[model samples]
Target: MPAADAEVLIVGAGPVGLLLACFLGRTGIPTILLERRSSRGPGSKAIGITPTSLEVLAELGLVDRFLARGVQVRSAAVHADEDARPRPLARLELGGPGAAFPFILSLPQVDTEALLREALGRWPAVRLREGTEAVEVRQESSSVTVRARGPSGGETLLRAPLLAACDGAGSPMAGLLGLRRRVRRFPVAFRMGDYRDESGLGPVAHLYFTRLGSVESFPMPGGLRRWIVQATGAEEPEPSFEKVEAQVLARTGQRLDPGGRVWASAFRPERTELERFRAGRVVFCGDAAHTMPPIGGQGMNTGFADARLLARVLERCRRGGENLENLLALYEPYRRTGFRAAARRSRLFMGVGTLRAAAPRALRNLLVPVLTRPPLSRTLVGHFTMVNVPYSTLSGVLARERRLRLAGEGQADEASGG
Candidate 1:
């Protein structure tokens, strides 16, 4: 019950941690955000930002900054190699009048982090220490203490009532907490890069399902486009501009002469989620909690949702003098369930897109058109854009409201002697 260094000690300064710090700081709660990396890295890791995430940013008054720097994707087309003229198997329209931000936005992760950092500057209570790595953490009955090494190899201890872990997939904190993880790796690898887009694809995202594998292309904010191709047989092949260009040509019969290549890398997709999202006083968020395949682009957006909800819970506890433990107890189940659903959806997309057999591929290509019409089409769009994710505290609020309403009605009926 003694005074701690800060109200919350947040590990990692990615989108999740940065947004959490901003939220807590705005609520007048002291926060310390630590980042091992001194600077943001190059290239885009997660490009698709969902409408729900935009709504969360709007609540924080930071959505317009993102809107100005991102490209709006209104439609997506899925093409198969069976057609001779590059006909689309199915086209999903993302823009509609029902939603506030009708379409998904494509912005590089680096840019997203920079904007978050800028937003965090408005709050004077947040202390961000870059190039500081957390090396040790200790949890006591009433407080948590973290030992970190600075840039100059000096050690310092930081204590707080709560700890938020957003350190990513290879989180040392998760290991230190001794949480169990379930992970599965895909058999295939992918090569992805950002290139000067001269293909005239506009703002439409394209996915080509060929005999070899799948190729995805999406427009970026600048005059660039991101392309991801499945590298099935090449075990150690280098991901260069030529490899991606060749794959596109072989699959879709469309030649793309990329003007310049900015970034390229090969990676094997893996799905990972922890058994639980909390341990003692430490709570997991973002990649620290769950990691999914990049097929649906739900990874970062889901993390943003986690940070948003956790901020709300923490703020309520801080202001109302509520028990922090009771409020935080709701976070893990809500977020874990959402992550399971997202991982399942992502896995299904990966499986369908990477089908190379004739029977399954034929069935998928034939049924895609029919399933992508009317009601079914809307569901597909919702899944891809993550608008359908129910990872907020709204569900709990609605349930509580329903119970109160029922009780009031019962009292009214009793009073009437009915």
Candidate 2:
């Protein structure tokens, strides 16, 4: 009932939180985004932005900025590792005339964050407070309050009608809300690094499924290419340029020149989802809500979808003076269903590459060529690009809202006409 610090308080200034704040600000909703990190770190973890997420960026009028800076990867080539040489198995063409964005935009995750931050400058109502971490979250009957510790170690209390948790997989807000999480860890681990593009791969992404392990290569923007290799380890291994070069040469016969290496890291993949995306006045978005293996590049794009829909639903609720909780309640089921579908897709995508055995790998190499041709290739492209994901009926809810608005406008016009 009383005045709050902002209409909405967003915890985390990652891609999801930044985009959500931008969307809310576009609709005239005041928002405050909090980031625990004092500065942006260097990494290109999530690089592929699906066409569906591109549509959302286009709506925000920020797609051109991304397109101008990103690499348009139009296809991905799957190969069979034959001894030290890789034989082409199948190639997936990713875009068509029917699609608004025919190709996936491959940009560094850090660059993506920077672009989002730059776009935030247009939305004066959205405030990004870095080095401010949410220490405590309290959701009352009418408002949600958060106690944050600033860079100076001073604590500040902020309140809002709504709080969005975009704080990532290890989200503290999820813990503060006492939400249950379901986690499943995969047996696989991988090492990936960016290097100078010397394989003549162009903008095509390449995947080599060998008897030893998988080796994936994707082209990047600045004359660099990303290489990911499945590691043989019971524990997570620290990545070295030597490991990458040796494995890549052994599996694909393409030697990586270490002189042009950038950054390298190792990770064990896992899937995590919250029991629910919301708790009273608080709601989870981005990695805070769900996370899958980074294999398919679905993690950040899924969060982009979350921010897109949340923005529309929140704007509708505020403009129509609707019950915020009830509307959000309606929004959650759709997102949950969408996340489940995305998780399954991510699993399938990762599983295909991690096939180590000979029998299954042989079968895959045989079927991939057939599947990546003609009618079937269309479906494969959809799955790879994430354009085929329905993201549930959240769009239908907004569509109904649009129809109601048009009807109301027509009624007002009739009443005004003598």
Candidate 3:
């Protein structure tokens, strides 16, 4: 009978949470977003934003800002160690009959978060609480209560009818809800960094496969380039600018000065997914729902898609007096299917790139040229850009309708003793 604090309570102010807030606020829904960190972290954890995500941002009126601040990658050049010179084995162009923005945009994760936060400033209905960490979450029959600690070490309780958990892979909220998760850790480790360089690569991303391992380079905004090299093993030395430069030189036969290197870190890719994306009134999105390897750069983009879909569902619920529980139930199957497909694709990419055996590697090298041509190349581009990933609400509705029809037919036959 009492009015809740806000219509929706969102955890984590990362891109997914911020974008969700933007969507809710734009639709005139009151939302409160809580973030554990006081500020955005340094460096770009996830750099590649796909075309589908750009389309979603366009709908939110934030694509122009992203385009201005990000670098447009039109093509990808894959190379092998056999070439005398660092020549591309296959150059796959990423522009075709997809969305308006067909190419992938390379922007720092920090910049993307900043832009989302800036856009949220215009939405008066969204309140962001940075440095506020949710310590516990309790779900009642009709509402959810979140207990959070503030910067001054004081605790506060906020209640809302809906909760969106966007808190990343090690999601505390998901843990609090006792959700089951499947996580897979790969043996591959990578060291990556951004450097100030004028590599003639320009808008073209480069991927080099050598006897040592795979090395990837993508041009960033403001004369900067991001380089990532797959490590030999987990016990390999700590990643440094000097080491990355040396690896690039050895793998691709290209000289990259280590000077002006901005940030560098090491990471091992992992795949994680929840059995479902919802628990009562609390729903999960972004890394909270699923996390895949960074090979296709679908992790963040997938999260963006999650936010867009949930916002649509919530907006519909607000307009119509529909049962919120039934509408929210649709989020799990729709998103879990996409997450599984994307994760499998990412694993295939990593597996192919890290083929260690001599015979398979040779065969892959010989077949890659043919695979990167024409129809196959186009398919690969579409898959990587996420244009091929289906996120249709109509499909869900049609499936539901079919189920209802079948149930009705069964009841009729049983009642008539047929």
Each candidate's clash count: 0, 0, 0
- In order of lDDT, best first, we have 2, 1, 3
Model 1 per-residue lDDT tens digits across residues 271-377:
88887798989999999999999888988888888898789888888779777777788788878878887888888888888998989989999988987888788
Tell me the lDDT of candidate 3.
0.85
lDDT, candidate 2, 277-351, per-residue tens: 988888898899999998988999889888887888788887897776667876677777777778888999889
Q: Which stretches of candidate 3 lie over 4 Å from their true place?
A: 83-86, 392-418
**Candidate 3 local lDDT, 1-418, one digit each (tens):** 5579899999999889988999999998999999989965678788899888888888888899999999999999988765444456888888876359868999989999999999998889999999999999998999999999998999999999999999998799989888889989898888887888657778789988787888999988888899888887568547677878888888877677656789998888999888768888888999999999998788988898889889988888889977677777777887887777788888888888877777887898998898888888888887868787766343454476589889999999999997
Instruction: Evaluate residue 261 in candidate 2 and report its C-alpha lDDT on the 0 to 100 scale.
Output: 91
Q: What residue pairs clash in candidate 1, if any at all?
A: none
Q: Residue 19 deviation, candidate 1, in Å?
A: 1.4
- The TM-scores of all predictions, comma-separated, are 0.93, 0.93, 0.93
Off by over 4 Å in 2: 82-84, 397-418
Candidate 2 global lDDT = 0.88
lDDT of each: 0.86, 0.88, 0.85
Alpha carbon lDDT of residue 355, candidate 3?
76
Candidate 2: give the clashing pairs: none
